[model samples]
Target chain A: MTSASVDESTRLAMYRDMVRARDFEQRAYDLFLEGVVQGTTHLGLGQEAVAAGFAAAMRPTDMTFCTYRGHNHTLLRGAPMPALMGELAGRKTGICGGKGGSMHLTDVPNHAMGSYAIVGAHLPIAVGAAWAGVLRGTDQVSVCFFGDGATNIGAFHEAVNLAAVWKVPVVFVCENNLYMEYTPIGDVIAVEHPAADRASAYGLESIIVDGNDVEAVHDIAVETIERARRGEGPSLVEAKTYRHKGHSRADPGKYRPDDEVAAWLERDPLTISRRRLEADGVAGDTIDAIEAESMIEVDSATEATRNAPPPDPATLMTEVWADGGSEWRN
Target chain B: MAELTYRAAVARGIAQEMERDPNVVLIGEDVAAAGGVFKTTEGLFERFGPNRVRDTPISEEAIIGAIMGAAMNGLRPIGELMFSDFLATCWDIVANQIAKTRYMTGGQVALPLVIRTANGGGNRFGGQHAQSVENWAMAVPGLKVVAPSTPSDVIGLMAAAVRDPNPVVFFEHKKLFAAKQEVPEGEIVDRLGAATIRNPGSDVTIVALAAMVSVAEEAAVVLAASGVSAEVIDLRTLVPLDTKTLLESVSRTGRLVTVEENPRLCGWGAEITSIVVEEGFWHLDAPIVRVTTPHIPLPAAAELEDLAIPSSEQVVAAVQRME
Candidate 1:
């Protein structure tokens, strides 16, 4: 029922984040096609609103654990553009110091623990982090972001059960983009609405919102995050979103129908958010300036990362063990 | 030197570590006021308080998962699963997460965690509690598995494992916990992945681990009286196995006898025997003799349990077969 007390500048900031995520992903996809980036990528093309909404509501002190399609999550969690671009370019200045590629990006200082490649593996990990925060009497809430495919995993069930039993302050954000890779969720599970039905099974409150609407998604996230900080236990917020690109770099998404894609494209999150600002009496020049500034920032980061050095061969064995003052391996 | 039981040395090591590091904490069922099912964690709760020595619910998966999370946030957690056989309940956490986290993450993080559990089948705790499951952990890539046989070895290995960066699985023999030995007075640290020669001889080489080490040593004396000198090598750690010492001993003796308290099929003894055969193939005079438990579940009765596990008589017989 509550909405965020957003000002003109705050709305523009949210718009810029969405634009940056969208633009960076598009450019990365182009580079991936040209053989500049080596590995396959799962771009966050149409899911910018989910990241922008949640990241806008959360504090830098709060922790976030994400899945493979997590480039936007890392950027929204305050990972510098240079470091993020360096990781994609496989440079030493990357967030994981060029160790982790696109699938595993981490910036611990920003409280964004790396994304896990395994399906549903990070669920129990996030639950444990939230439990630690609660035991330490810290009001810091941990956010776990996963796709609809992860819901079918056993680790997801075990993690949700533990989180519910302990009443740990965590937000389980499921970015339900209708299709889990190629198989639609409707064909897999018997339940009509995945999050609404499953959340109640674990004794948690559920909220289903229009994920394409940035203002609505942001307001709902802010409320749920506050509830968690007040020790009111965990909540499941299922953002009904869609992806414009294929599952990975190789997939052309021929499995999905053309009319379905067109229908969702008409309700794009970025277009809707800007139109809402215009209707609310916001000036047009301010919005255009924000978009221009974000493009310049993204271009600078891309150039810096390309020029950064590759990781040293000797650095491979550094983080394997702690410096315990004993030369056991040498 | 001071005389201390193997169990006492292990308990002292844990208590000393907890007292030294504020980040070090222990979690297991019956580890608190009950002082662990084997009394290894005795008086720790009184000294360190409940926060440090926590009694977790009977969920092995949760215990390991929680420790992994704590370790990620700069806390050193020691989780105890009462028996090695019960590790099956949390195999996913151990195999998938704990073992592969470092490699899959491209070495971005180090798991500073220890899982201490009792293994080997000498006690009459039946099939559920008595089992030697060290080989399962040995098959895993990233985990470091260590099994110590004596009081002094237990103290040194425990301290080393606590300070190790990678996740270590410390397997303690339930039968050897009450056995007394001369231990060093101060704190001692031993390097892992090294084998110790308990008894030296020139006729034949007998390789053993955990509770079987004592039996191998006893059999060596019996073999000497019969004019068949047998050397005994205690494989202290299983994963980073001491193939160098094992092959060297076999090269000198030209014969081998592998002894273990676990089942014969695919046991840790099989791994050691394979290494000797592959590395020291030309040095072998006869086929490698394996003295191990029958391929069956451990029995509950004292008499049946004694028959199920390998003894000194079996080791002596195996040495004679090599002749």
Candidate 2:
């Protein structure tokens, strides 16, 4: 069951999710350029397959945590396009009511807790969530999605060790996208396969998968996630992939060689899925139709965000504490 | 009423809360099997078992992070930092995650977590282990900072902290662990943002916090010997400061003196100075005097430690200097 084959329709649905994420990123980038969206955005331009495949494998009740580059993950995890886009645009109707912006997107009803901006910080939180499930004796598993950079931090090690010691149900997904914001993983991390090596140190099973391959990611994620749900303890899955865009809103790709960039771009998740669909005797128009629908959805989301009202300044002081409490007496 | 030691009061408060709510739990290094280094969580491990009372690794960041996560998931976790100085090691988690989660989420979540840690000097635990850093939590907008001087107040404040729907940093003084006070038998809870006037007088108003409350009391006794009546107010909770009670007392007394064990500059005492000068300036008959430890790190030696910590003599001198 670890390498189980998924049905063709299900595969197509996952491919469509990748396209949705891609289209949303492109549209949001355009909106950002036009000043419709406020604040910097961390786009997962070339890392859509991991998000799409992981989302496809998880139960809605299973909780997930993400890094700042979380737009794709939140969307695939069932955040409404209007609310997600509204948040990026700082609208009152946003998922977090416009207070959290892009770096802190959350959809608790869908069970994706948040996108913590700090590196490696959410690992312990995810461990705690998984521990809660263990205490309840439930089948719920927590997935913590972080980049290659987070692997070196103290929290990553501390949380993973605790999870393994307790035998809690969690899957630490390390999306090894090669670069940790301009610095190569090789420069910072010494391990050949970080997640695999780190996992063994903590007595956890590790799996290495091609992150750009939607089918592969879905297969491996399903296997690990199911094991966790069955209380088989925590595991680490490293998905090797690359980000086609710059690190964030401002960076340009002067640091990377053009050949390396061209090589990775050719293996883009959307292109790979499209070629697979064509070879499977699926009509080309069917693939084109999926892409067209995704574009329309993203464009409409942008239009709605433009018309959405700005966050009200009058309620700025509200919600600092649950009971509207303050540091001083009124 | 029952007489309990300060540490015993803390344990009873937690045990009672855990008995009432199954969701309430304690997690920290040496808390479970070891019963905590200071024995603040003594016998809790045996009472609740491994599930409720957890012993975590020496990871302050993870300790705080787990507390925040557990609380968000509908459990109330009481995390122990061992020493208040260690708050710097996990400041990111404390300041960013636990303190700001509910606010950043736009009230979609409530933390309902308490971080209990030993603070203040008098033990020869050196600068790192014996300092009081309540100002770190007090400066953060979303945190509630509570410091209790006596066993009764410890029991009451612990009950209040665990029940409040916000993150509260409950600072326990290491010096007062063996100190005994009368505590009511069951469920004694104090209001978080209210001050208790330990002694009332018309000559001067003396506001003290945590360990300094006792210091202020001794100073008031000395002032009484000199025929100068002094009012002493214990500002139990620093964040949701009982500023109104403070202003009212200062208005009546027409003189103000604040005492705290933290450094004299920008400490809890400094905060009171600003509040009094801003609100009760016209009511004040003399300038507000703040009695605090000198602006320096605490020393390990006994003599230097005594000099660095605020004493009853300093509080009295500040009051007499006002006269």
Candidate 3:
């Protein structure tokens, strides 16, 4: 409905981004099982559409503040697969040189403003970036991504209210995947719609969309991001979706009913996007090639990351300050 | 040279930086129209305007979070967290988010930010409002902790903190707001991690910070009457600590005494004494002494608070006891 519509080429690009995100997450999950990736990782296995759609709608100048489950968003924002995987594996060739690990993937040049692990911490930081645009008279927007659990936190309300009053260019996107860590989000949140329902309190329009639908998510994102750039103020969007896998590594997700899991799996975001691509008269061979290419890229990225060396022991003593060294004394 | 108050230097220092750069902004609760809770930023709102000088809701997390974000982007934000004691509300933003972002990002983020708070006691604002938390910031990595004693040092150190390519928590002592000094005209910028020797002597080395700096100075005068010449050193910054200056003075004087307003355990004095014991062990002619507040919440009553924080008499007693 907006002037900046998604054309045919853009559609193919979004689909390709979705495919790559899926393949990359699958490979990363397998690596986690093999213990090649240490610590923990949160994946967007069934929630790839939100990242692909919103990232596709955003400009390169606009910044992104995503949560810990951020591999899909980072890749969709144009970060190389190898660098992201290398970061997950804690290698010297990682995006942050093995400093950030998986939960804090950041490529500032690419506008991925790091993935924060805390529940509602980055919301205010995103508002600050947007406030910079208003002060500098720039058109750049700041996009913040969080889970359903973040809506209950105090920082979320503070950031949203401040953004509305300041009329800063920030679009807060909440991916409501029905659960926060292990508990069902619905059991905790009072309102039916977590993010969009609270938008009214901050004087923002309540906009909720099917996060599983790439086009639906992209359309709302384009509208809100443009609205922010035009100085109309912030918007809260709730994208209803589900996580195909558990919250973290080793969460089999046995809490959900078997029938519910089957029903949701049938409506996978990748499948929905692929189906729409076919309905749009795209050649079957073309879709097949895109999928194959994504698999090859993920395989290659995994191989390269596995072959990479661990970070230098000296790096532990570096980067504590801007001087590029951790020396506190002369 | 025009005499200036310690509180006025805060506004002047921010004004200098705001005039030099359009990207430098001030955001906090009651910072724009009402100046600030402590009136430290009295003139900044009028001079910088509302866009650059912003007032926020009583949201400490949002204020600090926004500062971190703006710093990472293009803007250099100077956040005023009314009272330093209120840092407990948003410690995650300061300790976890902004502090670790640069190091975790592997030098990718240059968070050029300054958090100026009304720090320390001497007011009847009670324990919740009048805590000296420079030691809290000193314990965290990637944070440059600064607390100035004099009005001129306030302006100079504020400029240095604003210009630094990292995050600096500039603590303006609440007790020293009315303290006056003949500050020179024109721009005055000072370096971080440098200690100034307030009074030069060779008998004993007395180190102190912020409000305690003047207490140590007064104690030096008292010790002088008793024929005990004491050298007083004001530690302007705590993070990139001036261990060189401290070691040089301790090596010459062969005695070290620390005067701190913070509680006994894990104060900045502990760090200083540990360094002296490790590096300046042979230089010591006697045991190093630390004059600090008792480990308890500062009371609102004048009598109780006077007994809690480190005073000039206590510094003199602790030093004479060292002899």
Superposition error at A25 for model 1 (Å)? 2.0
Give the C-alpha lDDT of model 1: 0.82
Residue pairs with clashing backbones, model 3:
none
| Ranking of models by TM-score | 3, 2, 1
lDDT of 2 by residue, B1-323 (tens): 87799998889889988998888999999999888898889999999999999988898888888888778777888999999999998888889887777777677778899999999999988889998899889999899999998898898889899999899999999999999987778777777988999999989999988888899999999999999999999989997888888899988999998888888778988878887888888998988887788889999999999999989999899888885
Off by over 4 Å in 3: A1-5
Write down the worst ten-residue block by lDDT for model 3 chain B. Answer: B314-323
Per-residue lDDT over A1-330 for candidate 2, one digit per residue giving the tens place of the 0 to 100 score = 222387888788898999999988888888899998889899999999999999999998888899899999999999999899999989998888888898998888898888899999999988887787777666688989999999999989988888888787889999998888898888886788767768888887668999999999999888999988887888899999999888899987578889999999999988998888788788999988998998889888888898899888865888888776443564
Tens-digit lDDT track for model 3 on B167-263?
9999999999999999999898999989999999899999999999999999999999999999999999997899999999999999999999998
Residues B1-323 of candidate 1 have per-residue lDDT tens digits of 88999888778888777777777789888999999989888999998997778876676776777677667666678999999998898887888778766644455566788999988777788999998888888877678888999988897888888887788899999998899987767767787788999999998999988899999999998989999888999988886678888888989999999888778789888887877778799999999988888999999999999988889998898778775
Top candidate by DockQ: 3
RMSD after Cα superposition, model 3: 1.4
lDDT, candidates in the order shown: 0.82, 0.88, 0.91
Question: TM-score of chain B, candidate 2?
Answer: 0.98
| Interface RMSD, per-candidate values to 1 decimal | 4.2, 1.5, 0.9
For each candidate, C-alpha RMSD in Å? 4.0, 1.5, 1.4
Which regions of candidate 2 deviate over 4 angstroms? A1-4, A324-327
**Predicted chain A of model 3: TM-score relative to the true chain A?**
0.97
